[model samples]
Target: MRKTRAVLVSAAVVLGATLTIGATPAHAETLAGVFREHSECERVGTRGTDQGWWDDYSCEWEGRYRYYFLYA
Candidate 1:
């Protein structure tokens, strides 16, 4: 009764704090890596002109399709 309730509350608190400490740092590290890659691209002239989310290699072949499109 009372002992079970106290145990449950303590367990919940511990789990929540553990999750928070583990997840937040990973998210922050990912964000920092993205920013670093973006800045590196800016420094160079390799900015991919494509804006689609699933175009894996479309950026590097920007102008190559114009001639080949007539054959397709």
Candidate 2:
């Protein structure tokens, strides 16, 4: 009887651990906006950085610009 109880307890513990490890939270990717002008893009990038997000900016021509924010 003692041996059976020990085996059951061990099985329960292993099952609990497996369930906990298998359950993982999902993260969603967010894309902010395509801000035109250099200053606008810079502001977006700065905001992203301040919010603990990875920031990237791109420019096309003189006034066209865009910023991308990524979260890990």
Candidate 3:
């Protein structure tokens, strides 16, 4: 019975560590959307945080459009 319990605990620890490693983001930021207006981009990025999809966001201009990025 002790051996069986030890094996079960070891398996649980391994599974948890795997999940933690897999859940982390490999990159700092990823593009969420692009908009023609700055306000619109900010609005959408704000909504994303409010909805709990992203922790934080930033915007940048490329050409005539604004790009939105969400970072973990």
Candidate 4:
């Protein structure tokens, strides 16, 4: 009975770890979405002459300029 309990506990721990790891990507995607939504480009303008445009134009995370993490 003691061995069975230990095995169950170990299995639970492994499952919890797997779930935590799996959740990390989802959390990252959410965070990236929030970032993009709040980014200067979207809040300001794409054109260089627009107010706050310099910040957006210079940003690397702008959707139009970004190549990596496409889903994000």
Could you estimate the TM-score for every candidate? 0.37, 0.39, 0.52, 0.38
Whole-structure CA lDDT of model 3 = 0.77
Give per-residue CA lDDT, model 3, range 1-72, as digits (tens): 999999999999999999998895655687888777788888888899999999888877776443433333
Per-residue C-alpha lDDT of model 1 across residues 5-31, encoded as one tens digit per residue: 999999999999998878755222111
Scored against the true structure, residue 39 in model 3 reaches a CA lDDT of 83
Error of 1 at 41 (Å): 9.7
Tens digits of per-residue lDDT for model 2, 1-72: 999999999999999999999987654334555544557666776777788776443333333333333222
The worst-scoring run of ten residues by lDDT in candidate 1 lies at 27-36
Across residues 1-72, which tens digit of lDDT does each residue of candidate 4 receive? 999999999999999999887775533321122234435534333444355323322323556845322222
Q: What is the lDDT of residue 31 in candidate 1?
A: 13
TM-score of 1: 0.37
Give the higher-lDDT candidate: 2 or 3.
3
lDDT for every model?
0.38, 0.60, 0.77, 0.47
**What number of clashing residue pairs does each candidate have, in the order they appear?**
0, 0, 0, 0
After the best TM-score superposition of candidate 2, give how far the Cα of residue 71 lies from its true spot, in angstroms.
3.9
After superposing candidate 2, which stretches have Cα over 4 Å from the reference? Answer: 26-69
The CA lDDT at 17 in model 3 is 95
